[model samples]
Target: MNYEDLFIQYQNLEKSLKDKTKLLAKLEKAISKEMEGGDISRCITDTAVMKSVSAEVTSLLQEIESLVSSFDGKEYIESGDFVSQMLEQCAENGVDVTGSSPNFEMFPNKVRIDVENQDIYLDRKKVACLRPVVLVQAIKKGQEKLLKASFNANKFASELIVAYDLALADLGKNPGTDLYLQKLYNYMVPMSRFRKDYDLQSYAFDLARLYAVGSSVEIKDGRKIQWGTSRDGKKGIRILDGNGREEFLATIRLF
Candidate 1:
């Protein structure tokens, strides 16, 4: 694709990802609502909604897999366009090609890359991996709904927090839940910051105001966090950090 065409395609992909994300959010909300009123945890794992979510999730996973595997190079991570070629490069570079997400333990012969911590492991041991780049993209595609709930600066902030707390509590006793909770928190930090800074009060009156306008936060210098508008008149939210770009903790859509 030409530069313009590629750009357009990229944008289109983003939009498609966003749509899938909204659907996932709605599904999650349905599950959460059902669980909140009563105990449906057992039913949730096999519910139609959950199955649909899993299917959509699988599709999103494929997209992320495609995008991440498109690059294969020893010097630069973005070197190849084919997954097989990337695997060959990994073999050539002595970088172990481990099994990936949804099955971190199935393949024993290769190193394992854990999506929860964005880290790599060799035979159940930690290995040096600067993986925040791939992680940011993957999380963005897989957990859009959580990101939205986390980033909401409006009326849903309190409710979102409650739902998140419930999820953590419910999953706290379960080992499998911890990993997912960790991933959820990693993506929610930026969103939490937006809610905390953007809206001061939490009373009914204040909540009404908070609900009226939702904004985003951006980080500058990776330390300083700020909110407001962009140069092109896109009104949402942003933040700045003083320490420069930190690893991608989370991403919140401005629109």
Candidate 2:
């Protein structure tokens, strides 16, 4: 064919292909709408089927929650002795201890609780034997109750309040630590910015735990330690190596 004729034919074919693609897209869209009961945005399913499935799922969830809630708090407390109680408490709190060693770790409220060599560690520091019990109680009371209790007590509550205030003051500073503050606020101020009632003991427990987790601390020879804030305003664990160089270990975040 002549060049002009060939070029015209090529243009016509391209146009035809484009038209066909458009038609195919329109057809597919129509089919999808039909399958989706006239709504292309939704999935194809019988309304009755969806309702039945939802009801079943809701029922199962309720049953599961009921079974879980029925558990007496004493099951872990009365398991065996102090060590056994600690282990049981860890298990009940979803902390796994089935590994090869006696060291076990759990993340509740994004805070790490490590049971190493049968000693409980919160924020990597060895804590009292009653730490687990207090932790569990704080969790049960909810975050706000824990925060209020923590703030009310004269313990390490000031640090958290200061952090929270600093976060609020800047609104863009230390975004990493903001997660921890948000978690506390979500628990303490669910609807409004003010809630007066709180559990004192639970607050104290939560304060100690948060302080241990969110504060910057030094690990010396992996034994004796000093807890304080760094000059940079970032909180994390710092371990000193043999060369006396400080190494960043990990930052505690709200999980």
Candidate 3:
């Protein structure tokens, strides 16, 4: 089946499962009531109905799983035309996107879509479905429901300074030592607690914002961390945003 047909089938199967589940719930209550009222035949009938409906639900779930798992990479993930079509569909739906290959971000919410992995990340957590409309829905939900709270530069800088210091101390490195960008993310973002959801992707956005829009804190006498780019074929942290020219950040100098 084509992607559209597959998506529709998944939705229909889910609806059927939900209906069957509701019938099973009613049957459970009926069976209990009939048994308590000493209606043996009625209880037996309801129990049988419940068992049959439950079996149907199980079968539907297995079918759904099979349908989702059966798609080959050539049909979607590895197909050049499929990727293009997916992005085109999003643009037609009025979802502006950036970076046409390997990854794409649905703007103005920065919802990252990794086509290679077939994963959609909203805020730092993964969204569950491979549904094609997810690209549009992600932007809509970000605009309507998951609106972000204001980013606090002072709060983040304060926490980040501590994290940087702790990272240095833990590594047995001296003050003002250059730290790896990945090291900071692995060390700091996970160690500190924040009022809002601040995962690694959150770290990416926060750091990008700080670098692009200037932070409120000066770590030591106006000294702060500086990001360095890899020049000798070393891998760097890829910033997955569509708006900017800077793609990878490799090193950081902490003050």
Q: Which candidate is the best by TM-score?
A: 3
Q: For model 3, how does the per-residue alpha-carbon lDDT over 41-108 read when each residue is reduced to its tens digit?
A: 98888888888888999999999999878865445755664566667677677665666555565533
Q: How close is candidate 2 to the true structure, as a TM-score?
A: 0.22
Q: Estimate each model's TM-score.
A: 0.24, 0.22, 0.50
Candidate 1 on 44-104: residue-level lDDT in tens?
Answer: 7536765776687678667766764553323232221223343444445433233333222
The TM-score of predicted model 3 comes to 0.50
The residue pairs that clash in candidate 2, if any, are: 110-255, 144-187, 144-188, 149-203, 150-203
Report the candidate with higher TM-score, 1 versus 2. Answer: 1
Candidate 1 runs further than 4 Å off: 39-46, 64-255
Model 3 residue runs over 4 Å out of place are: 1-82, 90-134, 137-148, 189-198, 215-221, 231-234, 240-243
TM-score rank order: 3, 1, 2
Order of quality (lDDT): 3, 2, 1
